[model samples]
Target chain A: MSTIARSPRRAAFFLSDRTGITVEMLGHSLLSQFENVPFDETTLPYLDTEEKAAAVVRKINERASADGLRPLVFSTFVNPQIRFVLDSANALHLDCFSIFIASMEAELGIRSSHAIGLSHRVGQPLDHGRRIEAIQFTLEHDDGLSQRNWQQADITLTGISRTGKTPTCLYLALQYGIYAANYPLIPEDFNRVELPAQFKKLRGKLFGFTIDPMRLHRIRSERKPDSEYASLKNCQYEVRQAETLMRREGIPYLDVTSKSIEELATAVLHQAKLERKIY
Target chain B: MSTIARSPRRAAFFLSDRTGITVEMLGHSLLSQFENVPFDETTLPYLDTEEKAAAVVRKINERASADGLRPLVFSTFVNPQIRFVLDSANALHLDCFSIFIASMEAELGIRSSHAIGLSHRVGQPLDHGRRIEAIQFTLEHDDGLSQRNWQQADITLTGISRTGKTPTCLYLALQYGIYAANYPLIPEDFNRVELPAQFKKLRGKLFGFTIDPMRLHRIRSERKPDSEYASLKNCQYEVRQAETLMRREGIPYLDVTSKSIEELATAVLHQAKLERKIY
Candidate 1:
C-alpha cells in the first residue's frame, strides 16, 4: 500500500488596518486551543489598500502551496473591497468583523461606520491625556521613589522584591489608565510589629503580593548570585512577614508566584473594583 | 401614530473563563464602529462555572428588560455547557470562539482540546523567564540610567524630553519581550553637531523620536512651568538640532506628536523588523 504523508504544521496570518494587536491576540487565543497543531504565525498590519491585500493574498497562497496545507487568515479589515480581495487567497479566511458586524447591525438597528483604524484611534482628548498622565504618575511613583501623590493613586501594590510589583503596576497604568503605585516591603518594615504609619491611613487603596519562598529565592539568585538576599532563609522570612503585615492591616493580597502580568493586573482591577478610566 | 420609545444606550458584557482581556478588546472594537450608540460595558471574567453563567444570564435579561433593547454579550468560553447557558440569555450573543473554532476544526481536520484558560498560560518555561528578564533589563536601562547592557538591547530610543520614550520602551518590553532602552537627549547633546559617540557605532539599533516644538513646549510647561526649558524658543531650537543630528546620522525616526503609545511601539516593531522574542 502507498503511504500517505500529512503535515502537522500550518501557517496563520493576522491582518488588520491598524496595529493588528487586537486581531493577533484574538487569533492567538483561538489557535492555542489545538494543542497538537503547530502554527507559524505572521502579522500584517496596515493592510488598508487593495494592492496591499493582493500582495498578502499572494503570500498566503505561496505559503499554502509550500506547506501543502491551507493557511488560516484572520482579518479585521473594515473596507469591503479589501476584504473581498483577501477572500480570493487559497486559505481559510476568518474575517473577524464580517462574522459579527452584520448581526450586531441588525440587533442595534444602525449601520457601522466602516471606519478603518477606528479601534485604536484617540477617541476623546481627555481620555488620551488621562492615559499619558497615568503612565507618568506610575513612573514617578515606582519603587517608592516619591510619595507626593499617594493620595491620588487608584491602587497601591506592596510586596517584597522580585514579587512583580513594578511590571504589574505599569501594566495597570498602560492598559486601563489606572494610577497605580508600588512600594517595596523591605527588611526594615518586616522587623516592625505594626504596619507602617503611612500605609495605615491608605489601607483602602493598598494591595499586597506574595510569592513562594523557593520561587523568590530562585528569582533573587538570578539578580544577586550567592548573596544573603537571595538565600532561601531570607526569602521565607520576608514572605511570612509581609503576609502577616497585610493580614493584620486587613489589606487584600494575592499570591503572584504562578500568575502572569496580565492575570495579576486583572485580579487587582477585579478585587479593587476600580473603574477603567480609559477604554 | 402610537408613540414608541427606544433607549439610545445598550448594555454590553465581555465574558471569559480567564482574564477576559481578549473578549473585552474585541467587543470594544466592534462597539466602537457604531459611533452614535453608547454602550454601558461590564466585564465578567472567570465565568467558567454554570452558576456564574446563570447569574450573568439573569443580569443580562434584567438589563434587556430595563432598557427595552437586547444587550450584547461577547464571550470566549470554551466549554460547551457554559456557552449553552450563556446562549439562553435574552441577549445577542457573539461567541468569539464558536464563530471560528468549528470552521478551523473542519479545515485542519482536528478536534480542539477545548481547554479553558490556555490562552494566557505559560506555554514554555523559557519564554516566561525571558519575559521577566526582559522587563528587568528594560527597567535597569530606562533614561540612560546605566550603559552596562546597551549592547544587549534590541532597540535604543533617543529623543528630547517628553517625546513618549519611556512608555514606548516599557510597552515593547512588556508586550513583546523586547529588550528596549531609552536615553534622553539634553542640551549638551543638542549643542553638538554630530550624533553621540557611543550611538554612532550602534546606528542600526538606534531609533530617534521627534515632536512638534509647540507640543513639547506645552508638555514641559506642565512639569516645569515658565522655565527656559519650557520656553517656545528653546523648544524650537532643540527640535531643530535633534532632527538635524538624526538626519546627519541616517538613523530612522518617528514623529510622536499625535501618535498613541501603542501606535508608536507598533511602528518601531514594523520599521525595525524586530522579532518578538515571546508570544
Candidate 2:
C-alpha cells in the first residue's frame, strides 16, 4: 500500500473550449499514473468565449479560497486569451491542447485553426455527417428490432440479454461511426448448435459477446429477479453453450463481463476488421 | 495549397490488446497534425492472445507487401511479449501504453497489472453497475419518451431536431455514466417563450442545445426534404426562438453544430455539473 493512496483528496477540473473529451482523456491518463491521490473531478466544458472563460476562472478562484487548497486544472483551451485567463486562476494547471497544437503548427509550417472543435482532429468535415448517420442507424436497428438493415451494417453483435450488446454497439457508433446492431441470444437458443436463424445470412458481419456466468446472473437478476432465467446455473449454461457455438462456428468473441463498453466495442472493431464509418 | 495535399494515401492501424480507443485517439491526434495525407484506417482491437497477435502480424505483412508502404501502427499493448511481437512487424509503430506505464512504474515502485480491461483505469468494479444503469436510464428516458423519471436524471437536454441531443446524451451515459435525457424542441414550442412543459420542474438539470441555422437546415432537410419544417427560414426561426427561450429561462446551453457528440456530451456535463456516474 502506498502513502499516496492514503493522501488527502483533491479537486480536479477538466476544462475545454469544446466538449473537453480530449483533454479529459489526456489528464485522466496522467492522473491514473498517480494512484495515491484520489480525485473529485469537475468537468467545465464549452469555454469558447471570454464570458465562459471568466466564469471558469471565478469558479477556480472560489474553489481555491473555499477549499484552502489549490485545485488541479487540466485544460484544452486553444484560444490564447482564454488559456491565459485559466492559467492565471489560483490553481495548478496542465494545458493539453496548446502544447500539442503549437508544436504541430511549428513542425507543419502552418498556423493552426484555433477553432472550437479542433480536438476531434482536422480538415475533414464529412465525419460529422457520418457519425450522426451511424448513430441514427444504430438506434433504429438496436436490439435486433430492424434486422432489415443488418446487411448494410458494418458489424452485428449477438449475445444473451444484459451481455452489454446495446451499450457496446452505441459506443462503436458514436465514437467510430461504425454501423453496429445487436441481437439478443435467448437461453433457448442453446438448444440449437448454430447461431440464431435471424443472423445466419449476416454471418460475415456477426460477432459474439460473452460474460462470466456469475456476472450474467447478477445482471439478469436485476431485470427479472428470482427467475429461472436469472439463475446461476442457467447463466453458466447459456454462456458455455454460446461460447461453444461461437467457437464451433468460427466466430470471434469477447468476454465482456470485466470490460467496459469502450473496451468491448474497440475489441470488436479491431478483431472483426470493421472500418470506422467516420474515418 | 501545399504540395503535401497530393501526398499518397497510406494505411494506418490502431492495434491494441484491449480497446484501441486510446491509441486511435493518439493516432488521430498525430495524423490530424498533417493536412496533406490521406489514410485507410484498420482497428486491430482485443489482440490479447498469441494467436490474435500472429494473425495481426500476417495482415500487416500482407498489406506492406501489397502496398509497398509500411503501415503506421499505433499500439497500446502493455504485455511485453505482445508489444515485442507487434514491434517486430514491418510497420512504423508508436506505443502509447508501455512508455507511460514504464515511467509511472519507476516513479510509483509498482508494476502495472497489465490487465486487458484496464484502459478504463483501475479498481472499484462498481462502475460496471453504474454504467449499465446509466445506459438503461438514458435509453428509457430518451427523447422525452418517459419523463416520469426526469427528476432522477442528472441532466436533461432540449434542442431542435438534429441538433445532436440524442447522441450527445447517449455519449454522456455510455462514456461517463451520467444519466442524460433529451427533449426535442418542436416548431410549435417556438411560439411560446418558455421551455418544454415536460422538463419544467427539473429546470436546474436542464441544458439547451443550439446549432447553426444553416447546419440545422441541412440536417433536417435530409430527414424530411423540402418540408416546411426543414426549411432554412424555419431552422433559423426555431434556433433563435429556442435560444431566447433558454436565455429567458436562465438555462445554460451549448452550440453543438460544430462539435462532435463526444465534445457536446463533455461540455454539457461540465456546464450542467452532472456528476460523472463512473468517477
Mark the 10 consecutive residues where model 1 chain B has the least summed lDDT: B119-128
The clash count for each model shown is 0, 4
lDDT, model 1, position A2: 54
B-chain TM-score, candidate 2: 0.84
- Chain A TM-score of model 2 comes to 0.85
Error of 2 at B152 (Å): 0.7
Compared with the true structure, model 2 gives a TM-score of: 0.78
**Cα lDDT of model 1 by residue, A1-279, tens digit:** 656667657899999988888899899989999878888888899898999999999999998888888999998888889999999999999999989999999998889999976775644322247777898899889998897968899999999998888889888998999999999999898788887777776779999999989988988898799999999999999999989988888889999877888888889999999998776
DockQ of 2: 0.26
lDDT at B179 for candidate 1? 96
Model 2 lDDT per residue over B1-279, tens place: 774443446788888776666667656765664556566777767788878898898899898777777877777776778988888788776676664565545534566666555436642332467787888899888877896767888888887787878888888888888888887878677676565566678878888988889988887888899999999998899999888888888878878766666666766776666677663
Q: What's the lDDT for residue A237 in model 1?
A: 95
Task: Give residue B210's error in model 2 in angstroms.
Answer: 3.2
lDDT string, candidate 2, A84-201, tens digits:
8887888876675564555445533567656555336632332457787888889888888886767888888987878888888888898788988887777667787666666787
List fnat per candidate, in order.
0.57, 0.17
TM-score of each predicted structure versus truth: 0.95, 0.78
